[model samples]
Target chain A: MPHLTLEYTANLGLDADAALLALNHALAGSGLFEEADIKSRAVPLHSFRSGTAATPRAFAHARLALMPGRDAASKRHLADALLAALSAQVSSPGLETQLCVELQEIEADCYAKEYRHG
Target chain B: MPHLTLEYTANLGLDADAALLALNHALAGSGLFEEADIKSRAVPLHSFRSGTAATPRAFAHARLALMPGRDAASKRHLADALLAALSAQVSSPGLETQLCVELQEIEADCYAKEYRHG
Candidate 1:
């Protein structure tokens, strides 16, 4: 189960939904996950602070949570793919935007889910 | 840096911000993290699907992202604490609520931030 969450600062003028889809595509293109199983969402951050200075900053952070089992190398590969998509999505000329992608292993034993169809 | 996010269903009878504060308190009480450095937020899900049946379901899932170095026991302790607080906060009569707490380690090298004070 790959649950992708993209949290971006409000100052960043990027379409959060589009950015999420792009990142989802990047994950899907990696051949490591199924497009249908990836649950993606975006959160637009309005109030946030980073570092020790008020020199104006923005960021887009994405966290991908997946079922535990992937090797370290494969995890890094997924992280790389997502970071690139997030970086490109929030790229701005005059704004110093920090982008990060983190991977978390969801415990298969503790995780539960169900699918309902109409 | 420890970033915490609590995602829950909107139908749950709970104050998002209040629940976030309680969770923050739980994490702070763990004595494994600094209260000031804890960045926590909540996302209320208006539209979501959980299981195969439409019998109504609710959940409160929290993720804690911290700098790597904690042991398994310590991590479990933190998760347990948060889960307890979350369960107590989201308890309702005749409603099935799923609760989960996952811990993630933040790579210090990849994380960037700035803080400004008045």
Candidate 2:
């Protein structure tokens, strides 16, 4: 199972639902996960400071959590894909925005998931 | 720096802001992270399916991301602490809910952060 979370500064005036759908579609389109198994959500940050105080900037950070085993190259590809989707769907025009995507491997031994959405 | 994110089902009718604060405080109180370095946010899922469709249930998942290097035991402690905080602050009454906490270490070589909130 892959869970992708996008957190964006609230001031950007982006639609969280649309962003989530875009990223979820991107992940599913990558053929990296089953469409049904992909879980994506977005959070808006009302109070966040990014870059230097001299310039008011915005940021969107995505964290992809998946089971450990993927090769580094594949993970990098996933991050890049997610980043592209975020930039296209979530980034606001006329705003200095920094976008980040991080891939984190969840250790199987320590991780536990019980899905009952059958 | 550590970033903790809580993703909960929207049907639970929980307060996302309170949960974020509780989790942030828990992480800071653990003394494992500086108060200023702990960033926590919550996302409420409006559309989600958990377990069997026969029973409508909810789930709250927390992913803790930190720089790689903490030992297994320490990470377990952190997870337990986080789970406790989430259960205390976010779980709704009269709903069958599942709570999960996962610690994912960010590979230092691949991770990058640029904070300007000074």
Candidate 3:
């Protein structure tokens, strides 16, 4: 299972639910995960400080956790795709926002997942 | 910088703010990140499915993203420490909760960070 998490500053003026949907779509479009196995969520940050003492800015960061063994090129592509999707969906007018996406590999031996549905 | 993210079912009845603090403390205690550079956040999942189609259960998942180069054993230690801290802070009374912690390594060459504080 690949878990994609979006963490954004609350000042962005974007809907968290919409952002989560965009992220899930991006992950699915990347052909990296089954639609049912894709776990996406957005966490809004109300208290955050960014930039220099003179210029405060907003930031959106995404972290994708996938099982290990993906090649570097594939990981890079996933990161770029996710970042682009997030920026398109979350950016607001007249706001300088820094967007970043990091692809992280979850070691299979140390990872555990259990699913229950009712 | 290591970013620790906590994703849990919202029904856990735990204070998200308190859970975040406990996570920050656990990460600092692991001594893998500088106190100033550690980023911790919690996301409460209102809609989630676990186990089979009969037993609806709650789950807490923590993903720790760190810079590449940490050995497997060190990663395991960090995961155990984080899970213990989270379970202690977030578990609900008389609820069946599955707690999982995954350690992920961010590929260094493709990772980027920009900080601005005012």
lDDT of all predictions: 0.75, 0.75, 0.75
Error of 2 at B20 (Å): 12
Ranking by DockQ: 3, 2, 1
- Quality of model 1 by C-alpha lDDT: 0.75
In model 1, pairs of residues that clash are: A50-B114, A50-B115, A51-B113, A51-B114, A51-B115, A52-B114, A52-B115
| Candidate 1 chain A least-lDDT 10 residues | A46-55
Q: Model 1, stretches more than 4 Å misplaced?
A: B1-64, B70-118
TM-score of each: 0.59, 0.61, 0.61
Off by over 4 Å in 3: B1-6, B11-59, B63-99, B104-118
Docking class of 2: incorrect
Q: Is candidate 1 or candidate 2 better by TM-score?
A: 2
For residues B3-107, what per-residue lDDT tens digits would candidate 1 score against the true structure? 777888878888765677778788778888755666666778888988989777888789888888889999989999999888878855667778899997765
The window of 10 residues in a row where model 3 chain A has the poorest summed lDDT is: A109-118
Q: Tell how far residue B112 is off in model 2, in angstroms.
A: 20
